[model samples]
Target: MLRPIRALAAAAAALALVCACNSASGGSLPGKPGDAAATRGVSAGSIKVGGIVSMTSASGYSKKDTDLGARARYLRANAEGGINGRTIDYIGAEDDGQDPGKNLAAARKLVQQDKVFAVAPMSSVTFSGADFLEQEKVPTFGWGTLPSFCGPQYIYGFNGCLVPSPGGTLNQTWPEGIGQVLGGAKGKSVAIIANDSDAGKFGIRTFRQGFAGAGFEVAYAKASVPATAVPSDWSAYVKDILASDGGEAPDAVVSVMQTPNNIGLFTALKRAGYRGLLSDPTDYDPALLAKDTTRQALDGVHVLLQFEPFESANPRMDQFKADIKAASGGREVPLNMHMLTGYMSADLFVSIALKAGKDLTVAHFQNAARSFSDTGTLVGDRAEPKGQKESFGCGALVRLKDGAYEVSVPFKCYEPVPFK
Candidate 1:
């Protein structure tokens, strides 16, 4: 599912597929009075919305917290006077089960059956609905880790697309932050690996260049591991990695993989005595620490973060914590990157919706989003139209040390390199 969606998205990107349907110029839905399509999911006092999330998957991975994160943001938005006098009629998220068919079905259900005004926080790796949602002129939001987020007029990534087309700018945060951890990338070497899937291959392409651009010698870069299941043994992979750098282990190893894969790979690397920098984009959740095996496996590994760390004293961080607590029935929960994915996805949608003003319509929303900009968010300053092309270029590194997470590099913006 992830592979096919990415292949289609890549083909779509080649043609520069940016079609803001019915936006502002000459469409009946663009603020035309009495046009039902203009107000399909709107009422005098409410604006209906829904989400698509991979809450359950065959790989035993879940993004259930993403739904909760969206709920938290929406709850606070409602409490704060409901977006220009209209409450958000959030119908909640539909579980896509991470299947391509299920993903498209969920999107159709939201648009055709539930009649949502928009799909916010669409936090799933397999976004098979991108084409359908874009065709139907529905505004969709999610993390921009996939090709679908790039060059799509109707779909937007919360932090902009980290993986962009050639000639587009690449977010150097991960590479730059990792360089700081390694006392700079000069004379250093790294091995980058990912699951053997289209999405993973795209990640390797983007990041291999990124790390090399940051001045590290790319010892080995490959997307050769299995995607559907974690390998029971990692000796073959380990053998290649240890001998990647001129027949010696590289200085650092970076994984563009999810939790279970990271745990398995990191545990194997540690056992093999390759004690250089180990890092991944996922596995920052506190819940992993509860399991001694997971915590030990991830110990000393730095996790890349696109937003402010939870330990930050920033007032906005406090607000997010409070919002999550209230959303969770006053219970404290472990925070993770998936939660931020949903929160920021919702945040971006809410920000644009607010700009859309009292005349709520898909056209109005698209127009507003085209020129939307905000400052001091958890993900950093956001400016649209530009975001559709490049990332915000801000991130941090957090290391799992001694059963706790610490900020290895403070959140900051980095200069981006061309994606070529």
Candidate 2:
């Protein structure tokens, strides 16, 4: 659900740009090998930055708060004295509307017109701007759910890359955490479903191996659901799923899809009288609780969380809540994963910028990122180059009971299984 697309056409079209894009060649920013003074967005007193978020979308799935999240984090950083005495001049994020063309256009506008030093919290399923950002040597930070976050020197995931190439390690968090909830993964069976898109296919491949490695029988794994539209009738999917485990339903049903899809699928499964563990990565939002149908549909469902849950006592979580409240004009607001998405994305950028030292250039940022590592933060110990290849191997699971969310599993780092 971290990277949801409307259809295969969108992903295929966006990925098509990868071939035409240039790849970074070294630790320093490309183009001007040694000239830090000529960096695009760095001024003597400020470092200008921007973001690209799916603030609006055709399907009505908006991550609009992501912009506010980035703003809050940046505002906090500036208030705390900014990086190396240069306050971050955040011009805010552009709305991609979850379209490939618009995503690319927004990236171009940010770099070419606004000349942002970096693009943090670039949240959207259609990231056609990845190639352009890398080619331009822009240091971008975002959720590493997509393949673009992996193997890219100029791009980073706030929590490290979720999808990595062969020989790279896989995050065992999802499987291991789920295992903990079900007593153990020893003989549990799971049926995983996703959209029939590039990201969906990749998710199935990565997660299938992860679950199997965790000792679960992947009873049914497929990226067959149509991505363009949510099916009003999920009977076909439910029918196959109920019998996926040798004529009986699996012990758990995992949906690697967004809110709309999860709601439909989970509702169908429940109506079909299949009482089993239902899990997904995207339904942790507090906003969904307002609607009775959504609340009932997702009741008893466990959602994946790459970061510490809000219910956590982690001091960093408290700081995030405070920052979020301040960003929302001192008004308490409903929290969602999208807000964390932007906050953490900006946090990583700020962390690396601080390590970049007082010089504050693209080259300095890249140099700092090459050896960056921090511990006990929200996402666990973050290490780069390594993060560029694998996840931090940390996470937790939260379940919706009645109308509130409770941490089903404690936040902790787990040993990652090697991805074959």
Candidate 3:
């Protein structure tokens, strides 16, 4: 969950970032004049950058929050005059609650009607229209942590970072997250569950590998959960989970489910009196627990977070904290790494655009965003370069501690068993 103090602190930092907010907006960034939406070789006047996040509905709220956070940060950038004298005239939209049909339509509208220079980082690509923008070569960005989508087809993902060398997960969240609740999994039997969708399958597979790689026994791994129809019936699926005993009682259940079914999963687990570690890839927020009547049910479960808790003093996220607060009109926001990831994605692409100069094109962004260096871009999780050596590595495994999900791991650097 996003903390209020951090949001307040970030708002305070935005005031300081005003000067460095967009120093490049002085007509210098590549996607500026002749680069943006210029047709027939003519330059677009005010460089428009388009984006889509999953902000509404039960399905894609996290993705919308990603869009929301990105927009908020970009709004702060725009207020400071944008990149290179051209404010990032952003036209932000959402997939509308994980509706693939809606995202398909949103993609068409962004490219056709909006005519943006480039579309940027988004998550949970509605399995419905995963190829629209990719086939268009529109220079898109994504955080498709679910490995199946990480194939060469998507072309753009994980802030342009690929599948972290096969076994290495860009989000490597499952075992690491469950590690917080179950500690060392040497003798533990783990059960993995998720929807039959590609994302679910891939997440379970990668997590299984992470667990096995760390010497844990994967007691059960299943992703054949039936989606039933359009809007999935999660209650039925949870019943399936509860019914699947007879074998050795698992010590943990790793799930890669999306928002549409998470609440049901939690409810069923609680009712069955399963007192083991329940974990999910840090995709959606567990805040849904608070919103739903199942708040008390998710008592001891842990949620994996791919990035640093926003409040960490890594110097990388300090400025964003201030900017997001000011952009949200001082309303202490609630979120995890989505907003931070979105902010860095946009900022990193802008850096690439600046580097690409007047030669700015979709190809340039793909090339530049792919080559991010540590000192150059400090986003949520660290992807250090040769010499710099990251001060930290991803977020400390997080959990539902004292009514709020706070950092349970000690310092940084992926400690499987977080000693208090």
Candidate 4:
């Protein structure tokens, strides 16, 4: 009885499809290869693309301008006759709010409903949709700070993977640049702090090895800070960090967190009379200088950057500035690293898609990706598949002083140290 009922249902569905096809004057069915090709986000004149970004979050961190950066790159590409004469139909971006569930939902909406051919500028603290995007064979590009970017065939990081598992090499820019700032790693002590999240824990693990490998004494490393809420009181954290060197403050304190958390902690440290060197990966934005308190708190602080700073004299950097200004309607907005993140992500996608030739398809894109290599890019020399497991090993350090930024360490590539 069950088998008969199932067969009847299947027959009914087939009949409905045939009737629909007949209604369309004997047109082909939707699941055919020709239909699939036509239905994809590509056409003879354009390629549809979209983006996912953590534009807003509970902690007040926003990557909203990443959309603008991507738009700037896309606009430039389109102005220059597009990729193989097909203008990119960039659909802007989806705000994920940094929520994992929302991230997945946004990705699904883009693929299932929007039918975008690819995703670029996927700037988010969480990438819960990585697995779904991979299974669906959707090409994704973003800043590769999470483990999800590693070993995924369909996902790419614009600057290569920042986080890698054992047997992979770690970018030594952070530790090595810090070592250079302090004159030497020998006889120096450091404390590393991060939020109590997967990213944070992994950051602690990676940097612990990096600093130790650079000959710095890893006096303290902890990921006990809150991931979502910014703690108002930093006394307890300060106490632990101050005594991390067995009774005295470490020579340097490093934070692997965003600006809000950094401001609170660094302000607290100053209040607690910690005069040692301070550093973090974020907080290089010039807009922070608008407030006196923010400037004072970050005064003399060194920041780790994985690309050439906005102050670079490189011709490409000048072009980036011009493109951004044009994208913003001639309004000069204060630049941040997030902009570069988006620009580079889109730039990488465009570069590969162009190489895939005029008749673009997912298959062609992946084939091109396998051999993608470019030097003198804004981030660094890029190559595919290898980037899934390793970094491009390029970065620099900048220091803030009296409301200005100057390169403490020049932008350059360094050999990576193996992750133990």
Candidate 2: Cα lDDT at 328: 94
Worst 10 residues of 1 by lDDT: 19-28
The regions of model 4 sitting more than 4 angstroms off are 1-36
Q: TM-scores of the models, in the given order?
A: 0.93, 0.93, 0.74, 0.91
How many Å off is the CA of 72 in candidate 3?
1.9
Top-lDDT candidate index: 2
lDDT of each: 0.85, 0.86, 0.53, 0.85
lDDT of 3: 0.53
* Residue 87 lDDT (model 1): 90
TM-score ranking from best to worst?
2, 1, 4, 3
lDDT for each residue of candidate 1 in 1-420, tens digit (9 for 90 to 100): 121223433533332233212212122235557443467688778888899998987778888889888889999999999889889888989999876668778988888878788898897766667777776778888888878787778888888887787779999999999999899999999999998765687889999999999999999999999877889999999999999999999999999988998999999999999889999998889999999999999999999999999989979999999999999999988888888888989999999999988877777888899899999999999988778778999999999999999999999999899987
Clashing pairs in 4: none
Candidate 2 accuracy as lDDT: 0.86
Tens-digit lDDT track of model 2 for 261-297: 8999999999999999999998999999999999999
lDDT, residue 278, candidate 2: 96
Candidate 1 residue pairs in backbone clash = none
Superior candidate under TM-score, 1 versus 3: 1
